[model samples]
Target: MAGIIGRNVNGNIAYLTALEPALPGFITNDHKFRANDGAYTEVIHTNAGLLGYVSDLGHVDFYPNGGTDMPGCDSAECDHARSYYYLGESLISGGFTGRRCATYVGAMTGNCVLWGNLNMGGLVPKTGSSGIFYLETNAAPPFSRG
Candidate 1:
């Protein structure tokens, strides 16, 4: 089975790194990798919010509003906290959606002409998908325009 779940392993890097060679694919006897594995993503809070942690290899990386200074948030707290809000909203209401361009690099510049649409933070993962995504939300509750 897929083994040991770890997070923020900064302190244990050396130990973990040392064991990497000995372990077989990180010691997973039968680890199957998929695109939609648990909504893997890096959420970027526009404005006020810190750059925070980023996952370069996630199936989708959500950059809401495409800026650190989220449009509706009055303060940094609201902007940063919007990540949690977005997740909660996704569970109940229609989730936020992001539009990126053809390539990961092009998408970042806000040229969303391509069909790179992805829903951010969903109960079910978006399978067979991988790329950076961007979406805009309302300032208040029922944030999703969907």
Candidate 2:
């Protein structure tokens, strides 16, 4: 394509010469010149204080590794396997709110908070039917043994 011709001196500026009429802009002897396209123009400078330009459309990648996988479960063994699972843990120090559920699943778990009420219809099964639901809380139920 097009090229640049110039001279360089220790304390003097460089200039470009013999440029075609199509090339627009001031041709300096101490700086490099380039033609700009429709999109963005890439500019690079050298240690000698010379600058260069290149037209770049952009770049695309087929695969991007941005931690797409779910967290907490380091391996298959850690996974509870049940489609709906909820696990929570909390520590009471000096009367703090304490930690809540660490992991949760299912539509309700994903949509509602752990302390929120669950409006299960009479038809809802308490035991296994399709998926098992597990809830781990800090406090035991009213009738639960210590």
The residue pairs found clashing in candidate 2 are 14-29, 14-30, 15-28, 15-29, 15-30
What ranges in model 2 sit over 4 Å off?
1-70, 81-88, 91-109, 113-146
Question: Against the true structure, whose lDDT is highest?
Answer: 1
Question: What digit string (tens of lDDT, one per residue) describes model 2 on residues 59-144?
Answer: 10000011111134443232221111111111111111211122222321333233432211122211211111122222222111
C-alpha lDDT of candidate 1 relative to the true structure: 0.49
Q: Quote each prediction's TM-score.
A: 0.61, 0.15
The prediction achieving the highest TM-score against the true structure is: 1
Candidate 1, 25-109: lDDT as tens digits = 3234343222222324233334312433222224455666654456677775556566777777877874777886554444345
